[model samples]
Target: MKKLVYSILPVDGYYTFSQRFLELLKSAVSETFDLSAVIAPLESVFLRFETAYKRERKSEYTAKLAAADEARDRAYLALRHYLVACSYASVEGYKAAADTLLSILKRLGWSMQLASYQTESSRLGNLIAELGQEENAALLTTVQGTAWLERLMTAADAFEAIFQQKLTAEAADTNTSAYRLRKVLQEQIEMSLSWLEVQQKFNPSDKLTTLIGQVDELIAHTMTTARANATRKSAEEEALEEE
Candidate 1:
């Protein structure tokens, strides 16, 4: 019979950093658990608080309290569901919940941008921690943590619309073709960088950055080749005319 021994050793003085990093991840998981276990069951208490506050008012208190209580309950339910949705085991489940929450917020005329920002921030934080783990890295590589990425891409598409609008306005303001072209190119480059930054924040992988650099080099090379071909064609045409 052979005896097996399992040993754990610290790697490169990163033991403390690794432990703290894992703690941060565990803390986020703990928050989800706390919210589901503790905060979720307090919806009734929130409604009761709303009712009590409404009672302090003297004018049409009954209807007012009823409306207030209803709104409070709705908000409470939304928050609970949002948390539950975020804790879902799959990205599809999470997105379904997020979509419902977004619809509710939109109907209430709330700021969609704020909701998107918070959702992206939380998802990105958790995703970064998850990707740090060896087992989860492959599982989550293609999974989107939130709808914020889609929102960002949609916004990027809108940049084209904005550029067109600005170009039209600029045309009306001045007829400088050179200025318009330069402005459009500058704006397009800025928008592209902005989109790239958003993608990098969500998944900060060196491989992705390297891929982008490679693509850029390929584009530059293609442009150089095209320019050379054009110059050669012009020289050939001039020689033919001389002959």
Candidate 2:
């Protein structure tokens, strides 16, 4: 299997779903991107441990730290990868490498989805305003009710998954899409808050909560749909193998 190994910088709560999805992604990529894991930083606490240990008598912990650094270095060099640094400590000369790694993530379909939501919505709203005055806005709003809405929603789902992990670097979303979309929606919600209040549609808190709820529902539905699709694909592949 072609492997795409991740030596994620450890942050509290980040590894859980990423580790799992790495496996699933590998399966999907088949000969393209095999997934593997090494010790990622458990948290920013790693820096403290490294500093303290370096100050004290060198011990196994120090060795482990060194190995982690080395393994982290080797892992990045080994394949297409993404590194999320939780600490501000520079990797010295590796800044270029880090940027390159991030670019690889972009190529691998890991991008912040928040930009699209704003750009698309604004363009859509403008288009509606141009088409007519009264009914055009309503029609544009109703476009969300159509069949292809699900596909865009699925893309949003993918955004959330990437954003969750990529956003905070710790205790974050395992699904990258979930992370990305939540970030985008949060931005949108913030932008719309004053308008919502002015229009008396909802209080700021209520609007915030509503947007959060929508994101949550989108994530849930996306996960269910992705799982069903995976199951169906596996079944079909197995049948083909048997034939």
Best by lDDT: 1
What residue runs in model 1 are displaced by over 4 Å at the alpha carbon? 1-182, 190-204
Tens-place lDDT digits, model 1, residues 10-90: 111112222232233234334222223222323333333334333333324334433433333333333334434454546
Shift of residue 57 alpha carbon in model 2, Å: 56
Model 1 C-alpha lDDT versus the unseen true structure: 0.37
> How many residue pairs in model 1 have overlapping backbones?
0
At residue 126, give the lDDT of candidate 1: 43
- Tens digits of per-residue lDDT, candidate 2, 189-233, equal 233333323433443344434443443453354445445554564
- Candidate closest to the true structure, highest TM-score: 1
Quality of model 2 by C-alpha lDDT: 0.33
